[model samples]
Target: MSEPLLSADAWTDRLFSDGWVKPSGGVIAVQEPATETVLTQVGRADRSDVARAAASAKAAQPAWAALTADARQAILLRAADLLVEHAPDLAPWIMRESGSVAAKAAVELEHAAGFVRQAGAMATEAAGLVLPSSPGKTSIARRVPLGVVAVISPFNFPLVLSIRAVAPALATGNAVVLKPDPRTPISGGFLIARVFEAAGLPAGLLHVLPGDAEAGDALCRDPNIAMVAFTGSTGAGRKVGEVAGAHLKKVALELGGKNPLIILDDADPDVAASNAAWGAWLHQGQVCMTAGRLLVQRGIHDAVVERLAAKAGHLPVGDPMRGDVALGPLISRGQLDRVHAIVSDTVADGARLVAGGTHKGLCYAPTVLTGVAPGMRAFEEEIFGPIAAVTVFDDLDEAARLANDGPYGLSAGIISGSVGRAMTLGAKLEVGHLHINDQTVDAGPHSPFGGMKASGNGTRISGPANLDEFTTWRWETVKAAATAYPF
Candidate 1:
């Protein structure tokens, strides 16, 4: 059966900064993953276009920052309201471009909108405290916007990931020039620009440039852009950091992860297996916080693996628009082939495929593997697919060791019958976010989400911390009378 079409109004190629602009360089044909059809065409912005966007943001920053905090807050709140009003139109674009199922797509829409509202609240809390100073003098510190920001986002979870930076930047009075991944312009960044524009954001405060990596490089190198706020792979983030660092520009990075999920011996095998399925198979495991490593205590390893394999085989996989399907096609053929290649290589190196290591086009079957050890590519790398590798651990120490052995330390999950034991073990794990009696893949607009070590650049992205990422603090002192002076 032919899948239903996405909303008609969103199918266009125009770009927006101060206003809608026609494409001058090239065009990018966005393909629908489920049907392999050309869903829409977006502008492929070049270096010159990026420079123009940066300049526009620079020009708009001061006026935006000077506005009353309540005014800026109202605009962002209106943008949030607009998102909910238009979710039906926007959700389809998310599904068509990012290959997200309806449920996940709805979550993305609501998360994006909720983030904007939360950011508005953060704006009211951006004030600093007064400190003690010399006699007859008062000292104070105040938080201020960091001028223009360049936001580079990824394709998976396009709406929330992109909005995660943009909404915070704007709420803190910083203008932003967003360069979304070419594969997901409409769903990722363009809708955000439209909502803010309708909500009466000043011209040039929020710009959406749909293009490739070259455009992102241009934004990073531009002097007018005060900082770079990025969400993507660690490999690409390293390059962005290098450029921004060389120019002495501030940067906030939310990068990759190799998350671990541990199932204690006392836990129910069926319940643990079901949670594992949800963590590893949602959106075909494309999430940065997906549970890539499964560590099970020896007593329940065999039984849990059996149940997990059975769950993998039972999940419905097909078009994302289908109500019954649990798994959807990957974003593109390139991703599909990359995931297949990793699975093939790991299976060749003694990793036993307990259930599935197969694919029919972009829909790779939910797979479960056992005996995955150190040094194997699948064990060491981020597969970014619906594949879970299990490792048997003899004790809590062994489980913690296996979990923290990997380079990435984004998130981890512990499943135990005892809450005290789970909390004890959770403290030992070297991850930024820990879930007690839950799966690893989780996030919320009000939560301060990021990672430790290589997972992020020592900066927070959501909640009140988001305001700190996009703004700087300045100290001031006022003397009531002239005391002794050095000059």
Candidate 2:
């Protein structure tokens, strides 16, 4: 008989602290969202376990910081190489655990490797600045690592989300205690540990804990942790920020988005619809930057809606691990129910269900609704599912207003034949990322990524911004000798 892909023999079922060990909180069964089958059981960490992990991280951080920059860079670079080398094994684990299609899983693996490599390259960059000072003295402002960082990542795109923070934090010389969502512990937590372990990271410098809200809350409040980096929903991010703030800890949040995609009158209906369809339904619309609202100018509204609806209906939906499909399934039954409720509620509120509004088990058909107004549930809420609610606007003024109406300001896109017009309209929207002539669902390894308003705090992540996220500024002054003071 063949062994399981992530067998206990090949991977530890225990959480990593000082070492891989059993947790006081027993174990949680990690399920495959598409089939609703148990993929494996992983150790769950409790408050006590979080305490131990935080202590381990705090103790080991100084040594990690003390290492030469080249030493740290080498480990991160090797981890990136290892991730690419292990993609065959790792991609399947991500697909089975996260219900991502083969293509999406592949993209996640590639992006994660890029993020690690970017961090490795950043490690050797200048870490401080020299400034003008009074005569006979020198002033230097240096970027120093936060003592220990706690990372809370979500289940969707688990590998990419977790590593984006983990690699940069480690590269900046901070120890990390990562709490991945319980649903995707293997890809989010275990896979990271394995790669860094193989890269020869020092023991106690990195810990992976798969736990529930209690464990996460405990991690935020732990005294030893100096910062918290979180990627999840807005409600959860608010709680994390509040708790972490109370402890005077620096927090970096990449939260939810009800992102908008605007189609101008001059845009080609087919091309605009394609961009909207890809943005809204990609990965079953589980991405944080998924286009939740599609605002089309009145001149092209009907054409765009018709094309988008047709595209949504034709896209395949099934178990991705078994065969080729555009989308797999929602993360769980609860998520599926929430998505359906929003769709049903929106449809009932007089929005026309143009394409789909049905589900079988956890797989929801890509859905589209037209005549969706601002007050509708689908228009206001972040329906993190395969549903696209589109509304019409008479002019660019109304379009910008509609796009900016929602509480979220994560990502927005403007599709127009006139690039200047799109740029003019996009500049007015209160979003962190505004793409001209493209979709909102785009990111680069070196691009600064985050959200605004309810989507996230003002802080950013990735690229050169990581130095700011994982480190603090320290100022020092040197003098030829102690200045003599007169009383």
Candidate 3:
């Protein structure tokens, strides 16, 4: 069978250019998750480069903001059209950089491309409300772009998280400076820059700098940036949030999650089992909002585990670029170690390996563990990999209590016979978003996405709610005829 991926020659000749010069510290090679091969090398950014990029964005932002919102909307609409055509190629880049599967990467790219169109259409909804007052008195409030915005994207789903900031910032007419994961720069910042340029966005408005943590620290602390959006670990998110607070700027912190999947005794075992397994294994369970802990009613835990095990076994584990691949490898050796350590620690602490927790090179098996105790790190920490933990509980109240035990509140799912109980459970959970009878991570573009508690700040990216995140409101109270300040 011919492997489906760009050849080394083709990658060098077509996928990228000499623009991304390698850094001295490391070449920042893009790795193929399925094959464990180096795809390409990209440059790294330091404080100097990041600051320069941010300054450039600040300089270009005014002109971009001056451009009519309709003009920006046209660019977004065009980007969406271009994305549908380029999914095949773009998907591979994401796979190489982010360790996302080709099929899943296509979803992220397509969503990213359409994000502009969707967000642009939301321009009409950007209108501010009018306050009620005297007759002939009118108050008009409008959303204005915050100048230069810094975006820091993590290794897991690098392109999607980066674009989460880029699409909105550009669509809303704010210039963006993107700081992608240092380990996976070529496929992220560089590729995204190319895509936007191909879509006809102004050059200076969008700049890419692949850099280390120091570069990120510089970006967050920059006074020129009016806003910042970050996606990664909860500890990292807190650090960025602290810097943002220091600057007194708007920051969107999309952090970690220890999301739970609750299966009621009366819920359909087959459906719950299938959904829980899929949720745990999708993208090899690297997603921040992945449902890592499975809490099933004792009445159905055994059945659910059996079915979930079968489902996990059936998922094809292979290279991400291949169409049939259901899961890919972790982003790097460090990630692999972290994932393995967590699973091992939990087992040592008395958890039983139910289905997975085995690794073959970069490919970690879709793991399912049971009999997890509260003392285990896996029980408290974010799994961030394809290891599912099944913990049995007797009742709905107890299930909810255990689900909300973690400091993270990114997302959670509930499967139950009663819609009322499901809704009630959703509210009781501390998560920013709850998935009822489904995966914790949402796929569609229309959904308002964010986390709550330690999982996130008041930041939503693409929905009607998200429109407000990228903009600052300005209210003008002009007289019906003419109003003047009384001196």
Question: Which of the two candidates, 1 or 2, achieves a greater TM-score against the reference?
Answer: 2
Per-model TM-score versus the true fold:
0.96, 0.98, 0.91
| Model 1 / residue 192 / CA error / Å | 0.8
CA RMSD per model (angstroms): 2.9, 1.9, 3.6
lDDT of 1: 0.87
Instruction: Write candidate 3's Cα lDDT for 352-463 as tens digits.
Output: 8877777777888898888986778878888778988889998778888899886878888998888888888788888878878776777456777888888888687666
Model 3: pairs clashing at backbone N, Cα or C within 3 Å: 34-319, 356-367, 356-368
Count of clashing pairs, candidate 1: 0
What C-alpha lDDT values do all the predictions have? 0.87, 0.91, 0.76
Model 2 segments more than 4 A misplaced: 1-6, 10-13
In candidate 1, how many Å is residue 134 off?
Answer: 1.6
Colliding pairs, model 1: none
Ranked by TM-score from best down, the candidates are 2, 1, 3
Q: How would you encode candidate 2's per-residue C-alpha lDDT over 434-475 as one tens digit per residue?
A: 999888899868999998999899999999789889899999
Report how far residue 8 has shifted in candidate 3, in Å.
9.6
| TM-score leader | 2
The lDDT, on a scale of 0 to 1, for candidate 2 is 0.91
